[model samples]
Target: MGRRIGIKDVAAAAGVSATTVSHILNEVEGKRVNPETRQRVLETARELGYAPNGLARGLRLKRSNTIGFVSDQIATTPHAGRIILGAQEEAAKHDLLLLMLNTGGDPELERKEIDLLLQRQVDGVLYASMYHRVVEMPEQLRSVPTVLLDARSNDPGVPSVVPDEVLGGRTAVRELLSHGHRRIGFINNVDDIPATHGRLEGYLRALAEAGLAEDPRLVVTETADAAGGYRAALRLLQAAERPTALFCFADRMAMGVYRAAAELGMSIPADLSVIGFDNQELICDGLYPGLTTVALPHYEMGARAVVQLLALTGAQDQGTGPAAQEMLPCPLVARASVVSPPRL
Candidate 1:
């Protein structure tokens, strides 16, 4: 409806050269502009409603300034909202937009969509997985700067952001141990993912740190679901020397554990102490007395993946070195489920 305000317009209004305005607006690293001048240019640009022409900038810089988010079944994930929200908010801070595509696990569709994104000149791409696991980067994505989300690769050259599974598992066990739980059991997932193996290592590490010998029978692998949790809990609790506490690999499995505990006439944190991972609030909060658990850094993972991608594409410094695999720590979310074990 009106003539667009350009950088030159803001520069003229702010009594500075267009180059100065460009440096301030583009946030070119190592450019020394006075803070007062920067503030004035920003204020003037805001007042004049000046918006850079994305097309002109992209053509000149040979970059779209947009990222491609390619995911498989991310929508079906309960924590997907938080992950997307984190990425979107962080990208906005860098003045970048994400072009999203969900391929529904169709490899052909994924490749085609990625090619379409490349055609649009996206500066980079985030190849996201619904859960933390190992994934091979697609051939089409190799042509562009890419980062994996909640996933890792066999190739160290591929950058990624995932949760520190070992640390997370150790954290959960340490919490239980702090409450005087030495005779503990682990309800693990049978899947051969990083989480499955890393968490098991963490469990063993924490036990050793406490000078407790490993009891091979205490760690049981199940299907990572409520039914599996129920089955695992029954086996552990029915033993001659039942565990005083149990750490579940997932909240859903913890739900089944609750069911088993009830059937066995066990009161949580009284007859048995319980903890879980993933911190799925619906399961954690809905359970009576709540469920103390270790929370996966879903939002942080998304944000960090963008940082890795930005580094890969040379979009931002992010004060980091060469793009490499990064793992964020999972923190403890405390509730009412875990406490000192019952005096046997």
Candidate 2:
């Protein structure tokens, strides 16, 4: 291709100085120029195909029109890819670019990535995780406008956008209860994770709300995987008076539950109702009977983090406020996995 056109070319074509061209094209605030001259400069630039240099413009304005997106395993996971897509789409809407870097859960690599992003003078930083948990922010990240996605920071000044796990847990139980299930079993994930605690709280809350006594024998905690689910489900189903319905902490766990049910010669929704969290289509839709589950709202959390970061950076007109800890809602996705308990 021929030599690319620049602002100097536009200036020459419009018979105006390069400074005047810069002022008109960049819309430098508080600078006054004749309307006809402004129109002429714009038309000439367009005709010449002149494009502004993002790096140079950012240097001059002391603000980069770029966002640094740092994630720990989220980029590599197929289930959470929508989070990146949502952030990218929202950034484009504001005419900004996203520079993504995945650290694969390496703290040293994460620090290096943040240093590189800061060197580029990114306007803001978005720290995301594959799952919702508390994150320790790197010292370098504290200097810039930053927001946490599907995670929380120890620093109260940093804002976070995550799904409401407690609400999700309650919704899952309510769905089972609505189907006339009085005896329910909860197959929980490991006890240390924040989600485990929150979900258990919701389960207890829902049972209390319905005037049902908590059954100690009905609750079991195991690893957050299919094997764990299988073992837990076996124990729950083998009891003399087994629960008519089961609520799993995650979709993967629910898949294990399905296996256990099949082994016991039980059909889903007919013999035993089941519900799961995380509307992972791979597991939920692929099951013999589509698994009813709750969605984590990954996309909404990603999109809202960008919006909130922009507000923190004064890039948007939304009112400024104290650091926000926003929890987006998790909506239930109904499917064939849940039904009324079978009558004796």
Candidate 3:
């Protein structure tokens, strides 16, 4: 093997001091090295294959330049790729890497995996959840700079990033209203989760804004599945005054609604308009008259989580203010499903 290239070699080759080479190579801030010298040093370092020892450098800087992405059951979900991709791409922008860990919802395993990450002296962590929900702050994470992705903590002191459930819900309903459907039915999720409540509030808020009153009978809570959606749709459609449009809490529920509509001999868009949430591509694209829906910003959530973590770790100068509870808006994905209601 040839002699290992070092800063001295690059300095000699570039006709500059070792200190000048180090400052330029390490990218130390506030240095006033000449641009010509800096460029020549960089070129010489590349030519000589002079690579700095990342471990030694990290030790000197007291940072690993790596971020830990720890998630529970996210690997098994469809949105996992987008979320991971978002964080990974953003981290790469800062010449950082992401060490991912999936705990499979095991609390003990989570503790152990987190310990492993901490052992590496990671700059910070992104504690992500598969879905939008409230999660308790893990005891192991408190000592480190952390940001919650697609989840929130009860402690307002911790920063978190989540989709704006209320706005998403309102966005879905507004799509229906825009198509001139006033007698709209919202098939909401039965579970008492943030999404369940936020969407409902959005539904009401939209109706109120449009000078319409909330019809208690128009809103029904179901199991948030195809079966539950089918059951609810049957009840709503069988009524003497059936809804002209239906807004489902989830795309899965919309599947049931589609079946219910077919049995009742309703032609979608012509006889009824339907919209769903969660924009699961499989469901949205599989349906005959493709389901128009609201999409959770999974990719954006992951990217923003890193942005927040970078700020917390003082790696980036982004306000980094105390405990930001950021909420991103869910955008509408238009497909073949939504249209103006049938003429009376």
List the candidates' TM-scores in order: 0.84, 0.87, 0.85
* Candidates in descending TM-score order: 2, 3, 1
lDDT of 2 by residue, 28-56 (tens): 99999999999999999888888888778
Model 3, TM vs. native: 0.85
lDDT (10s digit) by residue, model 1, range 96-157: 99999999989999878988999999988989888999999998888888999988998998
Colliding pairs, model 2: none
Off by over 4 Å in 1: 1-53, 315-321
Q: In terms of lDDT, which candidate is strongest? A: 3
Question: What residue pairs clash in candidate 1, if any at all?
Answer: none
TM-score, prediction 1: 0.84
Q: Model 2 reaches what TM-score against the true structure?
A: 0.87
- Stretches of candidate 3 off by over 4 Å are 1-52, 315-320
lDDT for residue 166 in candidate 2, whole number 0-100? 91
Residue 83, model 3: lDDT of 93
lDDT (tens digit, per residue) of candidate 3 on 1-344: 78999999999999989999999998999999999899899889998999998999899888899999999997568999999999999999999999999999899999999999999999999999998999998999998899999999999998999999999999999999998999999999999889999999999999998999889999999998999999999999998888999999999999999999999898887788899999999999999899999999999999999999877777445654688999999999999888988878
